[model samples]
Target: LAALLAPGNFIVMGAALLLNGFAVAPTLTAGLAAAERSVVEKRKTEVLAWAISALNLGGALPPAITGYIIDTQGVSVAFVIPLVCMSLSVVMILPYLNIWREKVREIPA
Candidate 1:
């Protein structure tokens, strides 16, 4: 991996990390908020199941997709594919930003 980090690759890697961090940070935060908001005081088991299912599903999908892509293509191309996916994820999330904002606003002081 260190050898892969030559000057030319460094720039792209840096940009990819930046973009991924930006995309993931809010998703993680919103996911946490959503799980918290969805929890019911009396039905702890159901809420736990839902949250765990969500977390497990979210964790499972990306690696499988990326793994298939990498197996068919080469590593460099595989690495680039996530950037495209992350960009699309950002676009998909843009419309829901208002929803996230509303959730954030609901947080008690």
Candidate 2:
């Protein structure tokens, strides 16, 4: 899906944004939930606060570089950063694939 953005077309951009919008709520909820669960009872509050702070910092930090890319390179190039980041993120998480599969879904089928 992130790859779809590389073309920088309106249709793909809208589709990507729509799909991302659907993901945002669940992702944010699960991320915070996982942070809350990963710590001892006492640090849960601090962890959540840090999670939120990181979200804010993540939100706040990207535009300068992306804007620079957009200004000098073009919007299409700017979109490539997400594709690269997504690929890197997948690779980074590959070490935990077994853990992910073990608890990926809990709902009974």
- Tell me each candidate's TM-score: 0.56, 0.70
Candidate 2 structure quality by residue, lDDT tens digits, 1-109? 5455365477777887898899999999987876676566899889999999989988887888789889998877875887787799899989987765554443233
**Candidate 1 segments exceeding 4 Å error:** 1-4, 7-30, 38-51
Task: Output the TM-score of candidate 2.
Answer: 0.70
CA RMSD per model (angstroms): 5.3, 4.4
Backbone steric clashes in candidate 1, count: 0
- Please give, for residues 1-107, the per-residue lDDT of candidate 1 as tens digits: 32256546877778767887899779777676675764455765676677779778868998998888888886677757757877998999899889867866776
Which model scores highest in lDDT? Answer: 2
Alpha-carbon local distance difference test for all models: 0.73, 0.77
lDDT of 2: 0.77
